[model samples]
Target: MVKVLQQATEVDYGFRPSYRKVWMAKQKAIAQIYGDWEESYAELPRWMLRVQLTMAGTVTVLKTSPIKLGDQVDESTMYFHRLFWTFSPSIEAFRHCKPLVSIDGTHSYGKYGGTLLLAIAQDGNSNILPIAFALVEGENAESWSFFLSNLQSHVTPQVGILVISDRHNGIKAAHEAPENGWLPPRAFRAFCIRHVAANFSLSFKGKDARRMLVNAAYAKTEAEFYYWFDIMRTENPAMCDLANRMEYDKWTQHQNSGRQFGHMTTNISECVNSVLKGTRNLLVTSLVKSTYERLAELFVVRRQMAEAQMGIGAGSLRSTRQTGTEHPASVAYNGSHRRP
Candidate 1:
């Protein structure tokens, strides 16, 4: 010991101690976020979240708020996408919801290329509810088809027995894609009113045309729908030809009870954008994941209130249509209630 101290008299290298302390502190912080810290202690109660979600305040607060999970996203962004796009509605919710319909995608604005494709349903009250979502790069047949094929996972065969969306030209091509070849025709797919409006407005361009189109759609009876359509066609001959040649079957879909139909419009899917209006601009790395975390928090509370009103027991509210080949339990559910 005496010999060693004598040799090291001025060689202590005093900066070494503080360097180790800083390194250790950084390691501890990383462990806290990743391993087990209680920060995610379900601080926001379900009911409180619902009250905040009521179309106003909840959405307002979601814009600037951030969470620790933003760091969890990977460098390639592919893994971040696979996690975020596939997480919403939870697999349980997907399994229980029935007659799922209406799929559509819209682009997101930010440095990162992203679009949102959503699968929606009509609740017992006839209001729209979302069951799954995807953040895509652009709106195309490929993206929409991928969303549908992936959506099949959430479905019990009887659950999403019918579905709807804009019947974009690429849809059939995607449906016939080698992987999606096995889906049945009865898992029916159709288009929404927005697609109708887009097709109609392209050929019939006047205030009168707009009124005729909207009125015919809102009409409840077959007679009323056709009577309105007949008048629309009589007023515009060229438009009539386009409707007959290109869109007649589209109008017929609503009239046919032959297949289950969901919503007349894509408004419900678009409604989500309104809910998270400004949150999309907040993060650099995991913007999609961050948006979803806020959405998941919002849905938890929103579903609580929705369930309470429907009188389903606490766990029952999470029920969904059976997917894959599982048999459905015989149960009765009404426009505003569910019973098993």
Candidate 2:
């Protein structure tokens, strides 16, 4: 912003603005456009309430801390702490998607710095379906617990679901805790293969070793996994020990019971983060509104595609019956179908 202001002024008035002057102007502009940081925080409850009212079945959970004056808590002076929200269509759509969820957190570059945590699911056709979102202070045990607990209760309550994420201690703590329902028999936890391979690179350098580790993680059978595992062990015996320490089912495909649905990474969440990257610099209210709009757009497009496919299938079947053709009506998911 400072550089942009400097260059703009230099071109318009032939005078480069001072860094401090540009910074002050930027703050004023933000205040005028999106309101100040504190005011944005105050607008959160009203914004969420409006969202719920405007969008039926939209779920929003906002956590606030009450300000205390010596001994009494002031009801009028509550501070925003955390928020979790999911749209009605997203909730309904997930039942038809693959039974897997990938979660990840991206740093917010807004007026008040924080973290944006996301939980996204994948459809049968390998499309990313964002399910839940949260704004928290940072990634910690308490924040993760709050996010996961709400996610499990509101968004993904189905049993035997798979969750893929990085092996952050906070996430581990939250999922492994019995009350969160993310433990065994309810939901299985797996590590993101990309993150696991990145960690492996920290211990062993070179692309060859990293590729070998990834091959092991992606192997779908015991024999294939050991084939790459033995190669890594031969190259560096300590690498085998390090990989063993991280556990097998958490990273390896062979041990995951096919629950991963071929999604070995948190790429869905990463994709969502990239889509919202520009909004990260906006005020909290603005950021949330942008996400709602984007997700609504996604849902509308997907719905139209599905409706078109159904129409194509119905037409194909009708044509086959009219012609009395022995050839069956085939429907391929390549966004278009052929006549029988």
lDDT of each: 0.52, 0.88
Q: Candidate 1 on 231-282: residue-level lDDT in tens?
A: 9778876755665564433445446354444356667667766665554432
TM-scores of all predicted structures:
0.58, 0.89
Q: Which portions of model 2 show Cα errors greater than 4 Å?
A: 1-27, 68-76, 326-340
Cα RMSD of all models vs. native, in order, equals 18.1, 3.1
Residue 282: error of model 1 in Å? 4.6
lDDT of 2: 0.88
Q: What ranges in model 1 sit over 4 Å off?
A: 1-84, 95-98, 176-178, 181-184, 247-249, 252-254, 258-262, 282-285, 306-340
Model 1 alpha-carbon miss at residue 222, Å: 3.6
| Steric clash count of candidate 2 | 0
Q: What's the TM for model 1? A: 0.58
- How far off is residue 30 in model 1, in Å? 21
CA displacement after TM-score superposition, residue 74 of candidate 2 (Å): 5.0
